[model samples]
Target chain A: MKKIFFSFVMSFVAPMLFSQSYKPVQVNFKPMFGSQELVLNDSVYTFNLKDSVYIETLKFYISGIELLCKNKMVWKENNSYHLINLSEENTLHLMLQVPKNIHFEHIKFYLGIDSGMNTSGAQGGDLDPTKGMFWTWQSGYINFKLEGKSNACATRKHEFMLHLGGYLYPYNTIQTIVLPMPAKTSAIIVIDIKTFLSAIDLSKQHHIMSPGNNAFLLSQIVAKSFSPWIAPSKK
Target chain B: MDSTFQKISIIFFLLVLLTAFVWVEETAFKIPDNWPKPKYDFTKNPLSENKIELGRILFYDPILSKDSSISCSSCHLQYTAFTHMDHALSHGIGDSMGTRNAPALMNLAWHSNFMWDGAINHLDVQSLAPISHPDEMGENIVSVVYKLNRNKKYRHLFAASYHLSSITGEQVLKSISQFMLTLVSSHSKYDSVMRKQSLFTNQEKNGYALFQKNCSSCHTEPLFSNFQFVNNGLALDPDLRDYGRMKISGDAKDSLKFKIPSLRNIEFSSPYMHDGRFKTLNQVLNHYTKGIQKNNTLAKELETPIILSANEKVDLIAFLITLTDRQFLFNPAYGFPK
Candidate 1:
């Protein structure tokens, strides 16, 4: 009779214990140029004051993700580096494991690759050298890439290329972004590219291939463009 | 009971022997006596015999190039102290030319930066520059990996080296780095004299003293290079107009600055300077004495004329020759894989 009672208790207790440990949370990144959702390679979006600019490629790295509750650390992702390529639809969603029953108020992440990973030698996956995000002339990785056509640009095809990255002092381009999370389980982070490129005049300074003051200023603008939106069901 | 005990003892002894063999292999990469600690962090990519051999093969293979006509060895020959002997500037595939001269390859594990411009900060990714340069190999790393995957021999080599079934760009770069790390040139006649194993001639001794006074500040001891970018006051060439480190940093103060090449194997690595403007040691010495063009960013040491008699110049050249390590230049271990 004692053994039978113990088995009944174990069956109920095991699942409860498992459920309390951790839960998988899906974080979706939705790229937007203003209110219009971006459809990669299909959507023709216009930006800048005159709305004569359009982007052909926009890709960047987001890393060092951490969850906070009341300014206290709750959970952090391991090897959290991710490359968000708008052209590839599957890369938009990221799965994160968070502690169960914890109220996460904010999500913090980096806009570019961290300095630690930059110095470390060739890595696999999204950080691989073959990803075309690496610089051949220099040893550092290109943190962010924005290439597109702009009528303001006087160059051939009216195109501009901005590849930003530098880890060293006085020119560090890494930007930290923090978004308030209303829902603990899941949220959609919106990146508005139009707002990010509002300040720059493409005609005067169309190309920024290496890291410097221009890259740092641009990355700062990008960091401010992300905002979290909670779905009604999750709220 | 006795038979069982004997079997257990034999098994234990075999295990001990196997462990020792593994330990020996892991500790094969040695640090030379009195040398500074290596800048390369070896924990990330552990050294092994198989990886080094694979790297040597890759170093000599022209398959890394676009048309399979140029290899790393084309510019870096073993006999000329791993530098192109005749060319003022490095020539690439299709007879295309590069802006700067190809620097010598030796004691690279100690370097914190690569290239004449100091553009590359690490050795592992240094090969990517030449491989992707339009005038150089003109091959992308992705295509290189694809080509390496299709080749049967590389497939076998990658498997043997990395114990993986497929080839990767990371593995290819790391293996090449392992081979380069083995190139530690600490057996020169100067090294022998420092170790008390040999004595320098009177001419060499005099030159050594002269070198200590004039050049040692930039071309530091032991490594023979300070490895810092400085403006040595070479006038800009109208055709090339290469600004060196300033091009990378965009700082006007760093204009015309270039990495100081190591004086080791100075006898063979000519023409000299970033542009290889001087074909002889005499020309380099003459420039130091008279050809220093005054500029805002010129090295302060070279501001005043370097005073040296004709005999003193010959003595300095003799001392520089002592830095040539015959063992390193002709080491079969570093030569083409047979």
Candidate 2:
């Protein structure tokens, strides 16, 4: 009985003690609007004579993060789900624990919550239903949410909303993003909101607020808008 | 040496105390004879007495509504098999009405999908729909959680059940699910006859035979539902024009198809149908006999009209009345918490 008792205690305490041996890797996310850092509601970006947008709410899930070396698996974050909200400063950065001497050349992650987690019952932390990313009338996470005002829209106050998510077959909007980068203690990735907006025909798809074909297509465009942050100089 | 001996004795006493606390906490949920295992994964959120009690309180509390004027019980009263007695379409706060009848809450753990359209995929998250619907509670889960956090009684109850200081959306939804999952109705006369504990009347026997021939394919026995979405040939109401499953699936073939509800406790749970169009058992039987509106999406069994003599219809209703579990309807355990 004493042996069983000690083993049970060790099971939980062992993980907490073991994980501290690894070095912490910082992954920073920089939300960009065209050539500048995107401000919540104060900044406006104009794409054309009739198209201008000011983002009011921007939030999405970054999940299932993995690091690869020589096209092979190296390290993976356990329970890796992050809800990145533009309005919250601290949430924009993720600290990943990695082995001190582990080698990696690529960082890969999913742009939304995976299908398994979608069907699984209530989740906590970043995947909490109270976070406003979950659909109330249905059962799936809103992978990408963007609420803003656009000049192209004719609705009340010219506002637009796009909530992209679907876990079922044929309409699964979860996208995988893999990028080649040098391994370091810290790295920055830019989410270019301007590129995503320009790629869309604003007049037609200004209000894709549900999971469907439009959300699936728009999710592909969202995937292409991401890139490693470049340092601009000599302007 | 004396101190070491004392420490071991104290540890043993603490372990005994913990065991007693757990022993008194959980009330075992037993599966009835010859019933299929429940689809709900109880291991994830195991049932406990305190959790179920907390859930019962939340189920009756009107704080979940927008104006604090209605609750889950407003539409689903316990005596009437947890369904609104006379309201055709469900009523909400501020005198607003919903588009469909409020579905009865019984034998829920057997169901994988919820709603007339199967919009809700899981039982744990099903509360989100009515809570946020414009015509129903008209309240969001975020606001509900915020309200729960501020309430002293709810917070104290939550802490007892989950042992968490702060209440969360997951805890709130899971606690409600625990209560709903416990509402199992298995002690009906139909079940007693099936188990050979009682003999069915000759009229009920004839009705059972007729039901198996015409209705058992869809409203299968044991659970009394195949749990499929089908077009039962009710013509669309032009004002509401609900396309049912097609709205969620976006498939043309799934148009006008709604989930087949279980017939358990059918005697008390009325008016019938998704829109609550049928007022009595006769109206519903007559619809199947003569009122089918033929469409491409109609059920295969309904392609041939069910011919029932007037006397046979009475016998069929007599058998249906045998499905009412008086114990389940009157169980104080499922009633308002003290």
Candidate 3:
């Protein structure tokens, strides 16, 4: 009787204790500027806008992805704004999981932080300023971003950066994208750089560092391009 | 048998005492009467005296800096109206100069947003600006948190304030907000005059009227600011090329707009505007009367231009002095923690 009782306790307690450890996953993001999609190692595309433009850096934030199981919300990160530093190409990965109990039909989530969190004070994880996705002057998170110089542009290889962020009226630029993570035990979200830059018109507007019309429009276009991945059910 | 009943009663009383302790720890914040409702939603993080004190210490401590050289008090000195008067632009760690003037921090509970550009939406997270800015504290939140966690004093303070063994970023921000919220500046001479306890001189009364006509539209009453971003017709600096609210709002109509500052304690906070262009009250009045810029988004009230005479300008200056609050300036609670 004692041996049987001990077995029952171990069976229930063992799984509960071992199930909570987090396993990190890498998310591969790719960018395509202009018609020609720029490759990761391709001799940095020397594209000129007007003056001597040299693309120095591009950074932005991605937040609030919900893990789904069989079309039900399994779990979601409370605060999830990811800083994408293209300078370090391989530092992209979103850690998420589909619970064992439910069979996940797909995964769904927003691309940028919600309005509530943006107005709310500083947060931990990717939302933290150590990530460099926050603005120092007007205190809000930069939801989407693109920075670099264009030689063709009027401002000589002057560093042009667009720090896109604004959740309030007239300047709200928080873009939303829902990608389908198909029913799989393990999967990697491959983000191709070529796909993103193909739609964005860098020459017409090269520098947008704050929340405004340009930032909002560009963020919308980026969200639209994400459609190919977000709606993979048809693909 | 009587001993058994007595022991049961004692155990029940101990349980009740423990419940009462938890109840007090989780008590909600109550808005003080006769004060404007707070813009911040206190339901998120309830107030406690312990948390407010911890935030006060952190606000005054330079440990939030990369080199422990500057604290929030470095720019926001308690005296001189919580403003640094010597320099136009706020100079930070290693003698780095920030782009804009560090506005005086007070009555933050009523401010919908913070900074000259309305950049920071919430008070809890405002510290991140100075903390991470290369020209400011030059410290990252994670590193600062780690440093605070390592320090025995901060750890004890956090434990006392939050009833936790470790301090989290949320606790740190919330505690700081508590302290900043307590910085009430409603006891100024102007407030007293309004309350009918004190009287303003003829010069001050005339100045107040001129201010009402020329400045009160943007710099409203009581708090002395509408808290809205406006262009105020100040010409953009060629070197800085700041577009103010236009940069944040992205609206072409908002070009060159900036937040209208409070007139309270305006006498001491000279070199005003976002860039600290005006050196004196006379210069500021001169701009109002003759220096109105022809921006497309200029306020309609200032379209015709405010025509204040030399003597009227002096009266306006006198009224501004009434806003100087001696009590607030010397409040020991807002002084350095030491």
Candidate 4:
């Protein structure tokens, strides 16, 4: 009688524990600065703008990642902020843990640090002040950083640096991006920098250091530029 | 078996009681009565006597700067309500002039934004501005951390306060914030009157009425300032070309807007305004009545001229003097860690 009762308990408890454990899903991000794929410091890509421009540096934050199934959030990564640098290839891939049996139909994330984190004191890891993404002059993190040299720019060395970040209303630079996931467990999301740069008149509005209308507009464009690649899964 | 169970229960109860005692002793941030809840969320960085003492030491230490000559105290002196007296703009390391005046520091826990432009939204990270500014400390956080780690004094303090093996930039910043958070200035003559502990003089009473009629709209009561960014009709400084809040928000509408400073220690924290343009209360009153430069972005309240007679100005100045909290200005606890 004792053995039978023990077996019955194990049958229910074992599956419960197994269901609690999650499977790791790896998502790869590919950043393309125009028609060509982004290669930091390679200087092979040209701007989609009218003038001849070379892409040198492209780094931005992707944070608050959430997995949604049937329009309901199934899982969300804690401390999901990631800083993706075009020069660093390893940062392009992110592994997110999700419930084993749940089917995640969509992925949602912010292009910049959320206001809650921004107001909170100095944080560690990707949000650390040591990272160049943080602005010492201001308290907030730089959401998107795009630096390059262009013939159209009138400044010395023909350089343009756009450090966009602000958490206030009317000039809030944080942008939310939602993408439909493919049937595969793992998928690639392409961030086409061409769509963002093409929309901006770089020569006229090259230097965007502070948060404002320009930063807000650029953030919106960048948020819309991300799409899920439907190619066959490697696994 | 019952005896054994009772003994174990007694031991557990004693342990819990001891832990609670220690926790209460460590967390001792008291909110003053009749004041709004502080804007700083203290749950993330709990206050402790050791951490505050460590922070006080850091605030006075020049080692945080590139050259070990300039400290936060150099620009912010406690006696003069934590503002540099007799300087139009803040003088930084090596006598470098900052574009804006170092505003008085008091009641910082109530403040959500820092600097004249409101660039820094959090008090915890506000110190980073002066620490890394080329004209200010001219020292990076990486170097500051390295310096702190090498110093035996800081290492010992960090171990005692944070129980960490090594010093970190976050620790330094948060410690300073803990110290700044304790600077609550709620013991002025105005506070006495508000609490009905004392009566305001006839002149002060009249001035309070006038202040309510004119300045109270922006400089709200209890805290004495609403702490919003508003263009107060000061002409743009041609040399500095500081667009104030506009530079941070990138909005044309926010041009010339600066954070409204608290009037807790107005007498000591002068010359006034973002640039320290006014040397006396008389000048400030005169500007409000006569010197308002009309512009599109000027505060709507100031657009209609503030009418103040010479006698009324004197009365207003008298009321402003009531805001001086000598107790806070010379509080030994807030003074340099000896």
Candidate 5:
């Protein structure tokens, strides 16, 4: 059903804008709550009739971007690791260099860093251990970090810290995300955080700070929450 | 023999010798004569004199701590095999006592895991553990880099080592690793005895045989450790409540298991065990022989009872003393940079 919806929108949204045209790919990720852009800190949001939440931090890694045309890979970014930070507006957008005169029907990217970069010693730039994403206790990147306060949370100051990451076997939480592209040169991806928050009972499972079955399961749900931005008129 | 061929061969040999000299000068680290191939991959961050010097400075500098009150050398003193012998538990910033003993630092290039529980897999990334530990340095890597960048001497040192004005965690970690990989402790009298340059006394020889029969399975020869995690049947310290490997691995079977530390400089690296319960070598020997706290997760090597007479224990202690390398303890290069 989701594949049908993507193909249906594939025809209705974008009209083969490539036509062998050379252009740089621009991706802008939007973090959104239900029907509104997700604002950090100052804004109060009420959900589940009892939960009042405010996101203090939202950071995740987007890596291994690949553009596909007709279910075949056409372009892949090299050294493609980007840490999308809500606080840093510039970090949420990426400018990828695509091959000249190529058409891509869909866009695919990893929601977290892969096992290769995780095991390979200390890295520079976005993957640097100094970036606060890497785990000091263990050798792995914290693929996704969402820290905030919720009224439903019973802990001190009503805080919840979810640091999801694992590269080792049986607990590797890296997730692959694929979205249908609807533009020629630019794409706006929406990570509907509402879908994520609604899926889990944040009160009972608020603190998932390590790699385990909880992190692995939560990572999959978070991956499914990402989608290509659809026009309000079309929606 | 053709005179022309012989002349060409001599020239070629001289050229080879010159190349060897240049190559050796490029890298300061080398795998010892008969040691196992190092687990650390040097191709990623090759050794250099400037980087090692920078790393040594970082090792001794208190700038890495939150309040600049502690450095790595605080817990790991060079004279005592790079580990504090006085304290059983490592004390860090704010005089906070840590949960475990700070193990001796030596031959790090061959270590597969760092920390008592084998939490860190790579040596290059091992410094992150202590630098960020609240009880240890109480400083994050980002904050440390910020501190390093602000210091003029560190900036110059970093530039000299990496040829980059901007300091990153990778450079800091790789430089520290370069210095640690140079800590090769293979000059002990036991090593000399193995090389036939020296001979063990009759009592020492008897102790060696006993060590081989009883302890060598885990504390293997040459490196004096297989570097495998095993439960050495240490009874749980109720006050500390530390379960070594199980805390990291999250497996019931791994409970009470800890990495078999190398006995390279066992004489100076006293207050042994993960929690440093035993103060002297005699206490350790007593634990192995009579105090084995038989548990379901206990090491199989300890299943058999080890019986040592009073004289035999003395001989074993004598042999253990031969494992200490004064050169390593007193090496000026590894001491305060100045």
Candidate 6:
């Protein structure tokens, strides 16, 4: 009777002890132009272009997401840079899990790559240099990529890939993003690209590749886009 | 058939087969009769046939690239002294052009540093640069390890080589370095002359004298490089704006400094310099003679202009040519596995 009871307990407890699950969160990206909005089916994001802008190519990376609850840090995933290549699809879906029993006041992350990763040699996944996020001659990461053709521009439909990344002194693209969580279960941060276009005056600055005032400003705008959706309604 | 006696017999047969295999692959490396002892402390990673074989496969395999398009062999080809000859600039995945020229890779165990700038301090970490460079192998060590770990063939190879069920990044890098360190190039005609097995022609003899007088101060003999840092006085590049040693040391005194490259096989390895600017031997000699610009940190030996005439230049070129080791270049063992 003793041996049978022990076996029964082992069978019931083994799976429960081994299995670890995390709460899931979904982010929907939408592009917009003027008052019109286009839902990206694959990665469809809205970009509010003040004027007609020719879209050639758009690529960028998002990284460094941390989950927290009740002012206690729970899970921190650093150096997680993922490219958002718009040419491939119209919408994007990224499903990530936040470990259970995590307590924190808010969730924090970064829009661009961290400083260490920019110089951490080649990496797999989204951080690979072959992904076109790395510069060959110069040692730096291309933080935010935006390139297209415009008649008003002097280059005029010329190939443009604005790789914005600088980690050294004077120029640093490692921007911090903080999101306040709702009173409920999880936090969902949506990046509205249409808002990004409206925030920038393209007539003043069209292309930016290196880390400078432009990168710092652009990263700030991107971070701001995530702030509004930080704590959705409790409904 | 399923009795204990049959099982014991099968185990005994397996042990004998394993011993036979070990014996067959037990070919040990023999250092050249008179060369200096290798600086690599082989005890850290013992010289074994299985590790070396696996290293060679990884070195030649293109799966290290993101799209499986480029490999170490793409730049460090076996022939032409293991330095690419197709273009001065080394090309990586997606036809991206690297800023620096691919240096010849041989006698690596004797050298203490790597790259034109010596960014990496250890041989174990040297492969990391190329593996991650956007214009080179264009892959990460982690991804490469994961890819290898997922493959059945690599799992078996790793088991045989490292006795591990799965391979790690450290193992992968070390294994490749093992094969590269085995690329000993001490069998050149120059080496034979040192051993008194052959004789140099009159022109070659004269060339050696000139090399000793003008070039030996920097391009030392035996290794053909003193493994020292010096400023040879190449003008600053405007576009790339690369400042070689200073960039790493962060010291202004070391500005424009570069690791002195080995003159061994200078014939096939061109164009020269960190950027491969000088394509001909004459151009290099001319730079040493008339082109060396005065700088605060220039090598004292090259501070004064080297005044070599046409004949002297020819003689120096002849001596540099003798450093070529044809035996090592065409060695079938270094070739791709059939």
Q: Write the per-residue lDDT of candidate 4 for residues B1-338, one digit (tens) a residue.
A: 99999999998898678667566547667887889988988888889988898889999999989998788999999988899999879887888989999998988998888999988889888989999998999988888889999999999999988778998888888999988988888899999999899999999999999999999999998898999999998988899999899887667999999999888899999989999999998999988999999899999999889999899999999999999999999999989899
Off by over 4 Å in 6: A1-235, B1-27
| CA deviation > 4 Å runs, candidate 3 | A1-106, A124-133, A142-175, A178-235, B1-35, B309-311
lDDT tens digits, residues B251-308, model 6? 7888888899887777888778888888888888888888887889888998777788
* lDDT of candidate 1 over B226-262, digit per residue (tens): 8999999899999999889998887999999999989
Alpha-carbon local distance difference test for all models? 0.86, 0.91, 0.72, 0.86, 0.89, 0.72
Collision pairs in model 5? none
Q: Could you estimate the TM-score for every candidate?
A: 0.91, 0.96, 0.74, 0.84, 0.90, 0.59
Q: iRMS of candidate 4, one decimal? A: 6.6
Write down the worst ten-residue block by lDDT for model 2 chain A. A43-52
Please state the error at residue A25 of candidate 3 in Å. 16
Q: Candidate 5's residue-wise lDDT over A1-235, tens digit each?
A: 3444477788865556444544678999999987789988868777777778889999999999999998898889899999999999999899987767788889999989998788778889898888889999888899999989998899999999999998877888999888899687899999987888888899888999888889999999999889888768863
- Whole-model alpha-carbon lDDT for candidate 6: 0.72
Best by lDDT: 2
Worst 10 residues of 4 chain B by lDDT: B18-27
RMSD to true structure for each model, in Å = 6.0, 2.0, 7.6, 5.9, 9.2, 9.2
| Candidate 3 lDDT tens digits, A1-235 | 3444577799998677547644433344554444344443334554333232334555666667666666677767655556766677654555554344544445565556678887777666667655667676577777766666554445655445666667777657776556565634544444443344445555557677666677777777767655223323553
Model 4, residue B129: distance off in Å is: 2.0
In candidate 2, what are the lDDT values of residues A1-235, reduced to their tens digit?
A: 4545688999999888767678888999899987888888897888755578899999999999999999887999999999999999999999998888788998999999998888877878888899999887878999999889998888889888999998887899999998876848877889998899889877788888778899999999999988888788776
Candidate number with greatest TM-score: 2
Per-residue CA lDDT of candidate 6, range A66-109, in tens?
Answer: 76676566777644566767666532445555555655567666
What's the interface RMS deviation of candidate 3? 6.1
Error of 5 at B327 (Å): 1.7
**4 or 6: which has the higher lDDT?**
4
